[model samples]
Target: MSKPYSVEQPERSAVDAMDGIVALEFGADWCGHCKAAQPLIQAALGAYPSVQHIKVEDGSGRKLGRSLRVKLWPTVVVLRQGQELARVVRPADEEEVRRALATAD
Candidate 1:
């Protein structure tokens, strides 16, 4: 796993040796979209035991989010072997996240 540029974020290489299901969520704590999708994300993640969930508190000076080109809240990027597999933005459907996770596994 490659080390993250910021200490507040997880290293991408942390999930490189796993089953290839890494979910990186970029959002601020006060963002409504982030809070709204929590339950759905949690529920969908329940079905994927191997998925690595990384919640990044993104904002000004957040390198990880900037590196990923995240421009909105609650952006979930599903990665496999340090490579991007799927991306969900402001998801309203739990199935959307589930489907993304399914791709990596």
Candidate 2:
């Protein structure tokens, strides 16, 4: 049961993995939307425990989030080999998260 890690800069190997689902969760711990989405995100990703979930502490100073053009908290970016397949911001529906996961398969 690995949860997301609050790292400032994510590693290239983690992001650019040529295989498997890598979910970059950009958000702040204090954000309400981020907090609310956690449960749903977890549940949605529960089916795919192998998926790499990286919780980044995004803010004005977090360059990675800005580089990814993340405008909202709890922005989930599903990637494979560092290529973005899909993204969801402030997702209220579990389906959206599931959709992100499906991209890996």
Candidate 3:
């Protein structure tokens, strides 16, 4: 909710080097599925305020998304100390996101 999906995406290396809890949200602003899930994502993220959320705009030729093997809109990849902890793609509700975030704990 604090930051919108940004076109200026970070390099895969930077993301992989991040420490602590990180939520990488891969999606395009124009994506309907991404738009629809914003509220749900926001609500779930609210509980994990310490988690770093980076909304990356994903599409063809986007190295970060490609490296992560993102094939759908709003793919939320939770990472702990630069390693993957959990992933939720096209989440249907806030619970799905919350559950994914819970893995960090």
- Judged by lDDT, which candidate is best? 3
User: What TM-score does prediction 2 earn?
Assistant: 0.86
Give per-residue CA lDDT, model 3, range 1-105, as digits (tens): 346788998887888888889999998788889988999999999999999999998889998899989999989999986789999999999999999999999
Give, for candidate 2, the lowest lDDT window spanning 10 residues: 1-10
Stretches of candidate 1 off by over 4 Å are 1-7, 11-19
Best by TM-score: 3
For each candidate in the order shown, give its overall lDDT on alpha carbons. 0.78, 0.82, 0.91
TM-scores of the models, in the order given: 0.83, 0.86, 0.94
lDDT of 1 by residue, 1-105 (tens): 122212376554554555656788887777778878888888888899778787888887777777788999889999877788999999998999888888876
- Candidate 3 worst ten-residue window by lDDT: 1-10
Where is model 3 more than 4 Å wrong at Cα?
Answer: none
Candidate 3 steric clashes: 0
What value does the lDDT take at residue 94 in candidate 1?
A: 95
| Model 2 lDDT tens row, 1-105 | 235448657655546854677888988777889888988898998888998788888888667787789998889998887889899999998988998789778
Per-prediction backbone clash count: 2, 0, 0
How well does model 3 score by local distance difference test?
Answer: 0.91
Q: In terms of lDDT, which candidate is stronger, 1 or 2?
A: 2
In candidate 1, how many Å is residue 33 off? Answer: 0.8
